[model samples]
Target: MIRRLARFRQRFGIAGRKVAVRTELAWYWRWLGILVILAAAFALAAWMYETGRRFAGFDQRELQQQIRELERQNGRVRDELKGTREELESLRAATAASESRLAIERSAQHKLAQQIKLLERENARLREELATFESLLASEARVSKPLSIHRLTVQPDVLPGEYRYRLLLLTGTGRREQQFQGRLELVVSLTEGGKDAMMVIPEATGDAAPAFRLSFKYFHRVEGSFRVSPKAKVKGVQVRVYEGKAAQARATADATIE
Candidate 1:
């Protein structure tokens, strides 16, 4: 190795009287080169680490932004859900109220139907009672022998000189429900020329027939109108019912004219 140095120094024109070769210096140079490579490697590793950290920080910020946006959307969804639930509750309340009203109406209808049925039953019972009373009265009437002039009425009519009369005759059980024919006469008293006068209804009306006729088993009603002199005022009425001739058995009814 000394010979190699001596030749290298001679070739480089660095010959000395005594040239010394340093083995230790060679070792130190080798160690220095290794240290320089290690420093470069360390610098490269540091740069890679800083770049990685910057990229990781950027990605983390983006992820945080996305998380915030997602949270806002979730909040809106929750609000909508709450509103829907509230509306549903309101609908349920309305439905419940309607159902309650419907139930009440149904109950009222049922009660009305019951009331109607009761009224119908009452009406039927009343009709049956009326029939029974009529039959009993008819039987009692058959057992009695009586005759009567039941009612008489007299009144002025529409025309100035006209008057009206009504008469009723009732016959009892003596006839045994047999029909009897009769004739009626009305005698009317009136003021004529400021003096009293009497007139028969048929004569006053100028009717050729002298009397009105009637026939009934139980009762008979007779009504008629007559006209007198226009200046005459009516005062009284007398009604007579004869079974045959005017002289035969008769019933009489009388009334004051008004």
Candidate 2:
């Protein structure tokens, strides 16, 4: 190795070689070459850095383009987010309105039910009151002769005085009785001058009824009445009540006549 360096120095015209080469002189030359290359690379890097600084504002258009793209994307995202929020709020409001309407309907239904119940109660009460009134009326109904006589002119009387009479039959039945129609028999007897006197049968006879349909529980049950002129001064009278051609339900002993 030393011989090789000596030979190299002699060739290079260095009597004493300041930098000696190793025995592997090829390897050393390559390493030295690499170092020189590295120094050249550093110089190039510095030159490039200085040149780029001088042209610093040249890429403004590209930067603006990138900024515009980003801004567009941001705007699109904001619009979409705002629309979504609005839709959600509208849905919430609709739901609230529906719920409020449902509540109102429920309240109305409850009130209607209450009103129906009240009406039913009132109707029932009214029906009961009407029934009570009807019962009272039925109980109080009785037969009455509120001046049941009418003066009728006839063709003849005792010595020749013609007189006629009209008999009206009124029923005093309670409210419980239904109206009826049938025959009625009213017997006519007489007493003259406050004494028992036989009434002479008149030449003409009036209408006579075998029986009468007397409403048992009505206000006015007029069975019927017979008109007769006995041509006697008899003033005493009597009356009897029967049902369905059977035994007497009521009998009148006697009554003073006017």
lDDT of 1 by residue, 17-132 (tens): 66689666587889999999999999999888877877777455677898999999999999999999999999999999999999999999999999999999978965865664
Q: What is candidate 2's lDDT per residue for 1-258, written digit by digit as tens?
A: 999987887877657547766576588899999999999999999878766765885455667888999999999999999999999999999999999999999999999999999999989966865665465445432333211111111222344323333233334332225443323333445544555544322222443233344433322323222334444554544444443444443323234445
lDDT (0 to 1) per candidate:
0.74, 0.51
Off by over 4 Å in 2: 1-68, 141-258
Clash number for every model?
0, 16
Question: RMSD, each candidate, Å?
Answer: 17.6, 24.7
Prediction 1 TM-score vs. true:
0.41
